[model samples]
Structure formats: structure tokens, C-alpha cells
Target: MELSNINWMLGAACLLAGIGLGVLGYHLMNAGARNAQMLRQRLAERDRQLAELRDGVGEHFERLGSLAAALNKEVGEATSRLAVEAPHRPDLAAATATMPEPEEAATTSDDVAAPRDYADGNRGTLSEDFGLKQADGDAPQPPRY
Candidate 1:
């Protein structure tokens, strides 16, 4: 028997339903990918922050060590000076003798360079012309651009 008109209508409806379901499935997959990308971005940001924190901690420890060494040297020097000035006080001399020499400290006062706000001269690190190169004895020229 020949197919009826109602059969074609049913086939068309089924095709439309399949297309709609495929579209929905593709959208869901894309949504999942977007969520995964967001999670990855957050993880990377967290890692960067953790790295910065670690660097900060390392710098803090370095400064702490230097400060401790300087304090130790200063105390030793003070103790020695006090012992010399007050020779009658044998206790002060004993204390000075008991203290370690300043040279024995991990770092000396001369080793730790003090922070300088001003440049040493025209070619110092903080100077504007420090890194710039030009011909010898040449005056400053205007920007090429």
C-alpha cells in the first residue's frame, strides 16, 4: 500500500525533534568546556599569587638575616667600648670577652650596602643617563622619533 500523508508529517516532526536535540547537546558540551576553562584560569591565578607570596617570604628572610648580623656586630662593638671605658668594672670586661667578635658574624657592616635614594654621580644606577649609550663626549640629543 502507498504511504499516507500523515506518515510524511510524522517523519518531518521526528526530523525536527532530532535536530533540536542535537543543538541542545552541542550547547551543553560548550558550556562544560567554558566551565573547565574558568577553573583552569582560577588555578593559574592562584599559582601566580602563591609564587609572589613565596618570593616575598624569601626577601623577608634575607633582610631579617642581614639585620640580625648588623645588630650582633653593633652589640659586640658597644660591649667592647663599654668595657674599655669602665676598666674598674670587671663584669663588663667579662661580658665583652664572652661575646663573639664582630668579624665572626655571617655578614660585616661593610658587606651590607645601605639603600641610597640619590644617585652616586651622573652614571649611577638611579641616574637618567645611566643605561643610555651614546658616542664619547657627545651631548644629549633629542629623541629621534
Candidate 2:
């Protein structure tokens, strides 16, 4: 009878230990599952924020492109209006005539004073002065070094 009671006590202790271990293991597994779920929620929220940022950037770029196009169109229209308004001015008429688009007038050399002809008549001597002065049909050289 004494041996049987000892055996029963040992069996009860083992059963209690097994039940405690099972409860502890179940709580640990539940905690791990909750942590994984929280991680997944955080990742989803981050993805949503990234998408919103991308959309905002795209909208900003679109607005910038539209603004650039508007500015270019306004500049073109203003230039056209100015050309139409001042059609008879010598410079304006010259610009419109498109005859080899006359090479830019040469800068005056420092050695020569402003021409007397330019003073009397508002037009500067462009090709005529150089043509008369050239020796043997060579291009005229600037007077100053």
C-alpha cells in the first residue's frame, strides 16, 4: 500500500508538470502569432503611404509641365503681337523681309570715329565703305588690333 501511494503521487506530479508546460507553450505561440499580425499591418500601412507620395509627386510634375507650356505659349503670342504692332519700323521691317537675314552689322573698330555719313543720314555705312576701301577684292580688316 505504501508503494502504491508513492507511485500515485509521482504520476500526479508528472501530469501537473505536463499541463503547465502545455499552457506555457500555448501562450508563447499566441504571442508570436500576434506579433506577426502586427508586423503585417505595419507593412500594409507603409505601402499605402508610399503610394500616396508617388501620386502626389506625379501630380506636381504634371502641374509643372503645364505651367512651362503656358509660359512658352504666352511668350510666342507676345512676340507675334509686337511684330504686328511695329511693322513699319526699319529694324522691324528688316527682320520680317528674310533676305539672307542680313549678317549682324560688324562692330566698329576703335581707330575710326563714328562715320560722318551715319551722322548726316540715320543709316550706318555697312557694305559700301568696306567695299570701296578693300584692295584687290580682299575682305576689309578691322582698323584696331
Candidate 3:
């Protein structure tokens, strides 16, 4: 009787262990699937957000184009008005007629200073040996502790 009971208990424990292992293995096998589904969801969400951003940018550019068109129309009207009025106004026409001569507009070499590249003579940042440390051969070396 005792032998039979021991055999039955052993069989039950083995069955329970097998069920536990099977459950664990099933979870392990499908782990990648769960992660893949989550990634797909995130990708879809990002795509939706990107579509919304593109739409907003398109609308903003449309608004800007309309404003630029309006501004250009106003500027053209103003220029046309000025052209019609300039012929009647002798003072405005006279000012436009008097253009400065090329010789008068020319600047002498002495008037304009040449561009400088360095801050100082040899110690400037642009010099090749500016940042290098000088070797001290005469100084005694201290012993390291």
C-alpha cells in the first residue's frame, strides 16, 4: 500500500511540474509576438501624428502665401501711383535727375582701413606654436610621492 501511494504521488508531482513548464514555454515562445504588436501600435500612432503635423504645415504655408500675394499687390499699386505723381511734382523729378558722379562716389585707399586677422604679433591664437608648453631643461625634477 505504502509503495503504491509513493508511486501515485510521484506521478502527480511530475504531471504538475510538466504543466508548469509547458505554461512557461508557451509564454516564452509568444513574447516576441506581444512586443511586435505593441511596436505596430506605436508606429501607427506616430504615423497619425506625422500626418496631422503635415496638414498643419500645409495650412500655415497657404496662409503665408496668401499674405505675400496681398502685400505684393499693395506694393505694385503704390509703385504705380508714385510713377503717375512723379511727373507732376517738379521737386521729386529734379531729385531723381541729380545722380552722383562715379568719381565722387569712389573711396580712397587711405579712407578705408585694411582688415586685420590677428589680435597680437606672435602670441595670437592664429600662431602655430601659440598654445604649446615651453620645455624647461634647467629646472630640477621633483620626486613623485
Candidate 4:
């Protein structure tokens, strides 16, 4: 009878330990499942926002393309009208017909002033006389060595 009692007690202890471990493992698994579900929800929300942004950008580009096409059509019509009226203006015709010869109007060496000798007191000769032309003033002082 004593040996049977010992065996029964040992079996009860083992069963209780197994039940406690099972409860702990169940709690851990439930926590992990909850975290994974939250992450999945956040990912779905982000994907929806990205889709909306892509659609808005596509619409904006479409509007820009339409505006550009309208502007190009207007420009083409204006250019054609200018071309038709250009030959009727007498002033414009004369200006275009008598373009001046560049060689005949070229500047000669006499038009530009020659280089002056700075060795004498003619340092201010090339400078503009600001109408205070006091040419009979004292001679310039010599440069220091």
C-alpha cells in the first residue's frame, strides 16, 4: 500500500507540471498572433494610401499635357498669321532689302587713339578731362624710387 501511494503522488506532480507548461505556451502563442495581425493591418493601410497618391499624380500629369497642347496650337496659329502679314509691311521690306555692307562701315586705325608714352609726365593724357581742363597746372611730381 505505501509503494502504491508514492507512485500515485509522483504521477500527480508530473501531470500538474505538464498542465502549467501547456498554459504558458498557449499564452505566448496568442501574444505572437496578436502582434502579427496588427502589423498586417498597418501594411494594408499604407498600401491604400500609396494607391491614392499614385492616382492623384497621374491625374495631375494629364492636366499638364492638355494645357501644353492648347498652348502649342495657339502659338502655331499666331506664327502663321505673322508669316502672311510680314511681306505686306513696306517699312519691314525696305529694312530687309538694304542690309548695310559690314566691310564699308568698318572702323579704321585713325578712329581709335594711339598709345601714349608714360615715361614723361603724360600719365593723365589718356584719362578723360571732366571739363575741369586745367592743362596749365604744375608739373606732376616724379615717382619715388
The candidate maximizing lDDT is: 1
CA lDDT of each prediction against the hidden true structure: 0.87, 0.82, 0.86, 0.83
> Sort by TM-score, best first: what order?
3, 1, 2, 4
Q: RMSDs, each prediction?
A: 18.3, 15.8, 12.7, 10.7
Instruction: Report the lDDT tens digits of candidate 2 across residue range 77-103.
Output: 999999889766468666777755334
**Global lDDT of model 1:** 0.87
- Model 1, residue pairs in steric clash: none
TM-score on alpha carbons, each prediction = 0.49, 0.48, 0.54, 0.47
Candidate no. 3 TM-score: 0.54
Q: How accurate is candidate 4 locally (lDDT)?
A: 0.83
Candidate 3: where is the Cα deviation over 4 Å? 87-145
Model 4 Cα lDDT, one tens digit per residue, 9-43: 99999999999999999999999999999999999
Q: How far is candidate 3 from the true structure (C-alpha RMSD, Å)?
A: 12.7
When 1 and 4 are scored with lDDT, the better candidate is 1
- Most TM-score-accurate candidate: 3
Q: Output the worst ten-in-a-row residue range by lDDT, candidate 1.
A: 101-110
